[model samples]
Target: MTNDAVLHTEGLTRRFGGLVANNNIAIQIHRGQLHAVLGPNGAGKSTMINLLSGDLRPSTGHIFFDGQDISGFSADRRSRMGIGRSYQKTNIFPTFTVFENCRLAAQSREPHPARIFSNALSYRTVCEAAERAIELAGLAHRAQRHANTLSHGEQRQLEVAMVLATSPNVLLLDEPLAGMGAEESARMVELLQRITPDHGILLVEHDMDAVFAVAKVVTVMVNGEVLESGSPEQIRGSAQVQVAYLGAEDEHHG
Candidate 1:
């Protein structure tokens, strides 16, 4: 493992019965870089994330984080090791206030989350971390509002804040911009761009415009395989990428 690499996979494969969701995949995510995994539906994007986060076990291969093998670790263990993920769906507590949700996530990272109940309302560190996360997600104004009361875009931002509360080194964002209006998507893009300088982000998104705008490196996956990996400009111009994934729409947008 190199010092710069935050996450590395070697020959990663996952099979469900006779179907192969991911096949012989190998990739490297460097520290403080925004990387994108681009592919059409059924390209094994979600499956790969499941494997990396230990939500699903790989049939074969190894996963390394910070130079340590983590193939056998659980998702919670991974999070504790500074690997955080935001789901495609909003995963915040609907009944909890935005600040409460963030506080819970931050507390989970502490040595004793149960103790948080004693003085959660007044705990300085927890309150401060929650405040920072809410602010980072642009939800500081809604801190006292119930999570379910927020707009869909705000809900998504809350989910990102929940992940941020964990103080992760690598953030695995699964479709952060999905289901948003143009304005909301633009806001998310701006927020994401601001955060990328501080965290290593691996984004899986269908929005070509957002992907190209934020990614320093883009890896194209097709039919459960990585077809090519390159800079955004290289990916835009690659004939293989065009044929396998980009197609005419991607070209026109590029």
Candidate 2:
């Protein structure tokens, strides 16, 4: 495990009865880099993210966060410990203004449960965090707009803002570009490029173009095991990756 890694998994394995979800895998996500995990269906990408976020415990192996062993921690605990995640589905309060949703997420990180019921606008610290997060996600102009009123792409950015509100050191983003069009995808790619310079990002995405554009390293998985890992150029040219994941598209064009 690398000492500089904010999130590291060692020999991580998980099983359900007789079925293995994640095999013996060791991966590192260093600070200030975006590491992307790409694989076909049933390749254990979701399982790996679940394990890292502490949603599911590893049947075998260990998870570390910020140099601390946190395999035993729960999902909420991991979030508080600077490990945050965004789901494929939009996760924001539909009725609330964009700022309000981000404010709530930021308030949750303060360790004061009573504040949950308090008027959110009263907290200066939380407001500042929300502003910073919204700005980071490129939604600062829409902060006052109701979440439901925004387009799907803006909603997705709001979800990312919510994750940022928690001030996490590592971000696990699952298919953030899942439903985006070309323009939205381009915006998201830009947002990722800006944020990854300071935080470690573990992205699970099917958009090979965006992944190749923003990721510093790419890890390819096949049937719950790592098949190859290297720079974008290397992954783009790997025969194994082309067969297992990228298919014949690259070969046809190359």
Q: Return the top candidate by TM-score.
A: 1
**Using lDDT as the measure, which candidate wins?**
2
TM-score for candidate 1, please give it: 0.93
lDDT of each: 0.88, 0.89
Q: Write model 1 residue lDDT over 73-168, tens digit each, in one string.
A: 999899899999998878889999999999999887664646745766666787788899989878889999999999998898888899888888
lDDT of model 1 at position 221: 93
User: What TM-score, over all chains together, does every model reach?
Assistant: 0.93, 0.91
lDDT of candidate 2 at residue 35, scale 0 to 100 = 98
- lDDT digits (tens) for residues 4-71 of candidate 2: 78889889999988988899989999999999999887889988998999889999999888788999
**lDDT, residue 214, candidate 1:** 91
